[model samples]
Structures are given as C-alpha cells and as structure tokens.
Target chain A: MNAITARLSSFRRHLDPAVITAFACILLLLFLGSLYSRNFLSPEYLLQQLKVASFLGIIATGMMLVILLGQIDLSLPWVVTVGAMMSSAAAGFGHTGAMLAIPFGIFCGVLIGLVNGFGVAYLRIPSMIITLATNAVAQGLMVVYTGGFSPQDSASPTMRYLATGFIIPSIPNSVLCWIIVGAAAVFLMNRTGFGRSIYGIGNRERAAYLSGINTRRIVLTVFGISGGLAAFGGVLLAGYASKAAQSMGDAYLLPAIAAVVLGGTSILGGRGSYLGTVAGVLLITLLQSILSVMQMPEFGRQIIYGLVIIMMLLLYGRESLSR
Target chain B: MKQWRFWFVEHRGTLMALVIFVVMFLIYASNHPAGFGANMVQTASNKGVLLAFVAMAQSLVVITSGIDLSVGMVFTLTNCLASWLVVGSPAQVILGIIAVLAVGAVCGAINGCVVIYGRLQPIVATIATGAIYYGIALALRPFPGGTVNETIADALTGKLFNFIPASLVAMIAIVFVVWVPFSRSVAGRAAYAVGSSETAAYMSGVPIKRAKFFAYTLSGLLAGTGGLFLTFFTYTGEAAYASGNAYTLFSIASVVLGGVSLMGGKGSAIGAIFGALAFRTIGDLLFVFDFDPLWQPLFQGVVLLLAVSLSAFGLLRVRNRLDWFT
Candidate 1:
C-alpha cells in the first residue's frame, strides 16, 4: 500500500493522470492483443504500426493546437482533400511543378485556415459553423476541379519517396516527419509565448485579453498551422496510395478528434499535454490495428470505437463538468 | 401597438425565414421552365419536407441549448429500420412505423442521458452516439437495399388535390401536431427557460431534467419522421453514410437560416421549416439558371457564409471588446 501510494504520488508529480491512464490502456491493449495473436507484440509489427500512426499523429497535432484554444476546425475533411488534389494537380505539370508540389498542397490548406481564422477571430462566427462552411466550399471546389470524377493526376516521385522511403535504416521517413512536427509542437506549447497565450485564451478570452495577448492573431496562426498540418498528412496519404481519391479525408475527421480527446486533452480547451496526444494517437492506431486483426466488421469496429471514446470521456470529462 | 411589436419580436426569426423562403422560391419558380405548376410544387415540397422535419428536430434541441449530432444517424437508423419493418400488410406497416420511431426515441434518450446524467458535454456525447447509431444503421442495411409500402408512401408523398401537394399539407399538419403542443406544454416552457439560463431555471424550480428528456425524445421522433419520409421518397433503404452526414449538416444550416440561435433559448421550428424550404431552393435556383449541378455545394456555402456574416455584423455594434467573449 505504501509503495503504491508513493508511486502514484510521484506519477502525479511527473505525469498527468490522464496520460498515465492512456499509457496503461495502451499496455493493456498490447498484452491482450498478443494473447490473441502471438505476432502482435513483435517489433517489426510495432514499427510498421508506428509508420501508419505517423499520418494521424501529424493531423492530430494540428487539431491539438486548435482544441487547446477551445475551438474546433470541422473543415479538416475538405482541406485535406484540397491539399491532396491540389498538390497532385500541381505535380501533373513539369519538373518545376513536382518540386513545388508539397509546399503548394500545404499552402492550399493554409489559405483555408486563414479564411477559417478570419471568420472565427475577426467575424466572431463560431468556429464550428465557419469551419463547416469552409469545408463545404472546399468540397465543392475540389469536385468542380476534378469535374466530379476521380483525378487523373497521380502523386509525384518525390512525394512517393518521402512517404515510403527511409533515411536511417529501419525507420520510416513518415515517422521522422511526425517526430519533427511533434517536436516542434512540444517546443511551441512549452517554450513559446504564442503557445502560452493559446492556453490563456482558451481558459478565458477576457482574462487573456486583459493580460495583453493578441488573441486574434494567435487564433489565425493556430488555425493556419492546423490547416498546413492536415495538408501535410494528406500529402503523406497521397504518397502512400500514389494518388488521391475523392473525399479521402472524410475518414480522418472523427478519428483525429477522438485521438486528441483520448490523449486527455480537454475538448473545451485550456488543459492538456502533447505527450498525452502522442499516447492517444498510438492507442487509437493500435486499437484499430488489433480490431482489424480480429477481423471485426467495419460496423462493429465503429461501434467499439464510439464506445471506447465515450468510456474515456466519461472517465475524465465528468470532473470538468461538475466544476 | 405595443402588443403587436412584442409579438413580432417573438416571431421575428420565423418571419425572417418565411420571407427568405418566399423570395427564393419565387425566383426559382419564375425561372423554371414548368412555371410553378402543381408538378413543380410537389417535387419541391417532396425534397423540402425531409429537411424541414430534420430541422424541426434540430430546433427542439437547439432551443434547449443542446445539440444532437446523432439526429442524422437516428434518421439513417430509423430509415433503415423502416425499410425492414414498414413493408407487408397494413397492420405490419403501422407496427413497423411505431418500432422505427421508438428506436429513434431510444437513441435520443441515450444521448440525453449521457449529457444530462453522465454530465458529458453534448457535442462529444452526440458525436460518440452518432457513430454508434451509424454503425447500427450500417449493420442493418450494409448494402442499402430495403423496401417500403408503396400505398402508404404514395399517399403521403403525392398531392392532396390537383393544386396542393400532399407533403406540404402534412408538414403543416405536423407543425400543428408536434411543434404547437410542445411549445404549449410545461416541459416545453421549461425547455425555453433552461435554454435562456440554466442556473436561473434550476433555481426557479423548473424540472430541467424532465424538460431536457422531453426535448430530446421529441427531437428523435421528428428525425424519425424524416427517416420515414426518406424511405417513402426513395422507396428503398440504403445506409448512405455521406447522406446522413449531409442531412445532419444541412439541418443545422437550415436551423440557423430560420433565425434559430445556436446560442439557444430563441427561435421557432416554424421558421426552421421555411429555412429548410429556402435552403432547398438553392439547388433549384441553380438548375433553373442552367448552372452545373456540381456548383450546388459551393453556392450553398457562399450563401450560408453571407447570412452568417450578416448575423455577425451584430458583433460590430459592441463597443466593449470583452463582450466578444460572450
């Protein structure tokens, strides 16, 4: 009893309870998964899983920034699609186009993000509605750009190389990309004034304003980063598939939100850690892998996914509500 | 004169929606080759009423300052269920309709219980439940093939007379049946009170839980009505995930267009119905003017942004920057 008490105290001092719980869930899932399939815990399989998780991790990091501000960007689906489609379309041109493909895709996302920021920060439209409207507009434009048909444009060689290629032996470039982004996110959230301002604004806009933070600019920059990250994730997806399909980003929205929340980040904002989000990304990716390994049908998978999220929310969100 | 102004203030949202719908429909009808004929009206009503029902469902929850993202999934689930149950003999059809509606209420009640009793935020709770409901729907109709009773479907969908669409009359009847009674009931008034100010409402001895439960259950029933009509119009049940999401989204837009406040405690379902009508007219307006069908989503988004901006102009009037926090 003494040991347990001491351990929990140290744990509380060093790590968030929600983060610990999530890591515990990840470990528990692994133990159970290995019991079901002997190869589930194998290093090769785990490494492969990390490679897949990189995509969602990239997007979730961006989502985290916005969620930390107590705002949401529902426009992720179309922004992602726009990124993939536009980048691929750009790559359809000559050598110059191929070179600029990646940045161009991300830039498209930034543009939408700015619009989202303008609506939310300046216009004071609720983030949910403004993002939703932009999502629709993006979707429509993409459809018209491709004339409601699947694009003939395929991902460039450089794009393909970035996703499937590895610089160091045994580590995927995609994972490296995720690490770079995650590190940047950590630094921003911990070391930067902008990141601190996000927490302040999220806690209470009036308080933050009184404290002299430029809340609107922060909102715009955060949304812009989110858009760029979503597009980057899309670029990775395009590379993996070697092309983009219609509405490919549709499947990412809920999972991204679920991952961020699962990581113990408050959906209402103002409280969370980047490491928690990382754990969340890993947990979600692993659960999905294990479920698919079990051959659970799509509908069944969906049901379990929803149930798990609710269970997690019930565990943590209850405290926030009561206060 | 003072009483009249007060009444107008109370009904302004609905009135605004009515005017918007009137103007849009007029433009659509004038531009159409069919020239606002009975056939044209029937076709328009058939499409418009589905959204109207969903928007009404949304309005019920929005009035209480809670959102039900699962409303669309309830719609899809009930539609899938209706396809399985709303076929066969007359007795079976009635039973099936009741079952579908019951399931919708159950789904909604689950959402309410999570939000109210479990103390989960409404947005996350409904998103979670929405996924579950959608999963059930997918399991029921994996391939999107189910049948509905053609006779009953035709009666509901067809024209009441040579000049009047049956769907429009039924929508009005539903307005009388659902919205009127709820707005008059104690629970309904409690809902409004809670929405306006929950802490104050609770202090005043309003039955907050009961009011919420009533609102959520009715919201489900209304969405179920939409599902039933969907089965009628399509005459088949397919678990179209995109369509469910679209309906959920569009209903919110319609609610906003109808002058229903996303902030809660304001607006009327009557206005949401017209809002639905106006939103539907966007597509028709495009078709009448020979724009590509692909342009529809962009057009809808632009119009919505403009409307939302018009509303946001209210923010400009605030001299105190802190008021923006509210």
Candidate 2:
C-alpha cells in the first residue's frame, strides 16, 4: 500500500498545474466555440484544426528547446521563409532538386541555426540581437535571390504529400509528423541524458558547466534543431499553400512563441514539458479558429492574442517566481 | 599608461561607434550629388532624429537590465495620436503634446508594473504590450490618413536660419531636458545599481523599484518624443506594422552599437543616440553609393554582427572560463 501510495504521489508531483489549466481552457474554448458554430465541435472540424496546429507545434517544439536554455531564436521568421523559398527554388531545378527539396530546405534552416548558435555560444552575443540580425540578413538574401519578384517555383509532389496528403483517411500527414517530433521531444526531455542536461543548463549554466556538461555543444545542437524544425514547418506551409511567397514565414514567429509560453513553460528556462507546449498549441489554434469564425479583423485577433499571452504570463509567471 | 588604457577600455565601444558614424557620414556626404550643404545636413538630421530618440528611449530600460520592445509601438501610437491631436490653435497643440507624452509614460508604467510588480520577464511583457500598442495604433488609423499641424511640422523638421537644422537643435534640447537630468539623478544611479546586480542593489537599500519605474517611464517619454518627431517629419500619422517592428529591431541594434551593454548597468544614451545616427548613416551610405536598396538589410545585418562581435573580444580575455556566463 505504501509503495502504491508513493508511486501515486510521484505521478501527481510530476503533473504540471499550468498544463492542466491550459487543458481546461482548451475544453472551455472548444465548448464556447461549438456554441458559436455548430460545425466547431464536429470531428472533421476538430481534426482540421489539429492539422493546422501541427505546423505551429513543430516550430514551437524547437522554440521550447531554445527557451529551455534561457535563449530565444527570433530568426525563425526568416529561417522559415528561407526554408520555403529554397525548397521551392530547388524544386524548379528538376528531378535531383525535387528529390532533394525537403532536405535542402531543412539544411538552409540548420545552416542559419548554426550561424545563430555560433554567435550565441562562441561569440557570446545575446541570442535576441544575433537572431534579429540573422533574420534581417536572411530577408536581404532572399530578396536579392528573388530579385524582388515572386519566387518562381511551386511545392514539389513529395512536399505536397507530406504537407497536405494523409496515409490514413482523416488523419493528417502533418499531425503524424508532429506526433513523431513530439514523441522524440518527450523522449529527449524525459529519457535522455541530453534532455536532462538541457534542464540542468537552463536551471543554472554555471553549475551545469562545473558539473562537466558540454554547455556550448548542447546550445549549438538545440539551436540547430530549432532552425531545422522551423524550416521544416515552413516547407509544410509552402506545400499547403502550393508555393512559397515573399515574407511567408513572418506570421509564425510570434504565434510559435506565444504557444510556447502559454504551455506554462518558464521563460527563464529549466522547467516545462512538451505536453504543456502541446496544450498551448491546441489552445492557440482553437482561439484562432474561433476568432476567424467570429470574423474578427486581424488587428483585433492580434490584440486578443497579445492579451492572452500577457494574462498567462501574469498568472503562471508569478507562481514560478514565488516558488 | 594604465590610466589611459583603462579610460580607453571604458569608452572603446562609444568611441568606435562614433568613429564609424563619422567615417560613414563623411563618405556619404562626399559621394552625395547634393554635397554636405545645409539642405543635405538638414535632410539627414531630420531622418536620423526619429531613430535617435527611439534609441535613447531603449537605452534607459536597457541600462536597467530590461528591454522595452514596446518603444517602437509607443512611437507609432503616439505618432497616430499626434496626427489627430497636434493641430489647430497653439493652446490646443500644447495640450495635445502633453496628452500624447502622458499616454506614452502610462504605457511605460504599465510595462514597468507588469515586469516589476508582476515579476514577469521584461522581454515577454514588452512584446505583449507592444502588440497591444500596435493594435491600438492600427485601430486609430486604419488607413493612415491624418494630419499634424503643418506649422509645427515644418518648424521642427526644417532648418534653423537657413543653416543649422532645427531638428538638431531639438535633439540637443531633448538631451539636455531628459537624458542629462535622468543620468545625473540618484534614481538613475539606483537604476544602474539594480541593473548591475539587483540583489546587491536591494540589499544596499537602493530604491530599485522606483528607479526601474522611472527608467521605464522616461523610456516611454523619449519614445513619445520620437513619435512627435515622426509626425513632424511625415506630416501625417501611419500605423505601419512592418515599420514599427523594424524600428524596434533597429533600436536594439543601435543600443548595442552605441556601447550600451544588453546585460545592463553600462553605457550611455548619448552613445545610443550616436549609434542611431551611425546606423541611419549606414543606410544612407548605400543610397549615396547607388547600391541596390535591397542590399541595405544585408549590409546593416553584417555591420550589426561585426559591431556586436567587437564586444566579444573581452570574453576571450577573461582568465576564468566561468566568467563567461556572468
């Protein structure tokens, strides 16, 4: 009995209140949304929202890892753009390019991520400034590459299949991709030594280093992962839209960040779970769906989105501080 | 030799920024079709002061080891408000100016409260508030069609006595009125203390909260000044989303270039103002050189990267590896 009780208590201790609250909010939002629109609660409508959210989930997963390290990656905007643009540009090059499109797009993201990581880890610049600079550089590069014209290529069949097609009828390929990524993230955080080190470093970098962790390598690796994931998300977006447009990735940066923070992850790092981020992604997606259903203007949706983030920060941010 | 080296070490960032700005400006002027005449200088100053004011605002919060991403939005919001308010009779214009400035201060105060009392991270808090402010601005001027008092606009944006730029005079006056007094005050010192080490400042009985509040509020006021100037230059209010975000990002670049530490408790607004000027000069340099306008972002990013990397040299000099984290 004592052993069983102990196991139960441990499980309860592991449960994050923020994630629970977020789940509750999701349920409430769904209920409210259904009342507003009869179609909102249907399985088909819900599945579609989940698919849309999968892209953000993928990006936010990378963002979460960086945020867990007490760093940020603002370059996601341009990185996503680069991923989409490059993949499309490559697709126009024929069979080899089409075959290599996805990898090449992801590679673009990883390269930029490498630059971002190098600056933050080796050069000792703040990630915010460095990433912002990289974003500008990426923007400039893309503009020059495109010669201020619309990108000339469409999404390849492989990308279109990955982004828009499904192996199972009703279950999205993108959601399956998210599940794979999400599962890996969970396994990384809960099971792997690297995940433990991420928490340790986030909690206290000096201590983590003194304890003999390769802090710099971990930072670079996470940044690379983040860059790659953001790019992957961008490629999916291009596939969904049929082609990449100029500044196509600008819309995701804030929403990705908002989703991460909403998941009850401490912005200061070292604490948070993928489950929380998952819930955050769902909540934001649902809120967005409802807003769109209500026909709210873009600016109004922006205001509400900003307010929700602030409200969440005030509530959960204080709890973390008190603890 | 040691004293001279110490002084040089302390002022190196600012001096470097100054030299870069001078060289770039000189190159721009020499290459310009209009030459370095009063008209040319006035035009440059008019364009430069908007960012200079915003950068100064950013410097205040940055000095407190906090960042105000909302400065750009506040600038835009105030610009929109000024277009609606800064018109008609002199008395009405004066009232309008005060109201606009007050709104900015209030915005800063809201940020301060959320960050300090609410114990939220400054970056996230400011981003939220920035979005809100931008939303308000967008709502205020959905299509960007509102006018400021033309007389006030011309007087501020135009030159003084056909030689010196009136905008330059206004910039200097604002520095005297705002930056000089704030930097000299006890609260300002407390702000620096808090930034350098908050626990140490608190233990030492520094009014950390008040200092931070003042810093953030003043930051808002400076941004408000920028917004007013933006109105003066454009003669209309626009709530351009891209422009606001660009300003926020560039202000950070300027702050870094100006020798202010992002970690806080170091550098000066004067440095940041020059940083802003230098950054603007870099943009104009491209124009004068006839480089493709598309190349500007790339060049700016490279310059920013190089400037930021300059400060990293000190990290290499530290004897203990642990010092790197600090």
Q: What are the models' TM-scores?
A: 0.97, 0.97
Chain A only, candidate 2, TM-score: 0.96
- Tens-place lDDT digits, model 2, residues A7-63: 999989998888988898899998888788889889999999999999999999999
Tell me the DockQ of each model, to 2 decimals.
0.65, 0.62
lDDT for B18 (candidate 1):
95
Error of 1 at B113 (Å): 0.6
Pairs of colliding residues, candidate 1: B144-B238
The residue ranges of model 2 lying beyond 4 angstroms of the native Cα positions read A1-8, A319-323, B1-10
lDDT per residue, candidate 2, B222-263, as tens digits? 999999899988888999888888889889999998989999
Candidate 1 docks at the CAPRI level of medium
Residue B56's lDDT in candidate 1 = 95
In candidate 1, stretches whose alpha carbon ends up further than 4 angstroms from where it belongs are A1-11, A319-323
Candidate 1 to truth, TM: 0.97
- Measured on C-alpha atoms, candidate 2 has an lDDT of 0.90
Q: Which digits, one per residue and each the tens of the lDDT, describe model 1 over residues B54-158? A: 999999999999888888888998999999999999999999988988888888788888888888778788888999989899999999798999999999999
> Per-prediction RMSD in angstroms?
2.5, 1.9
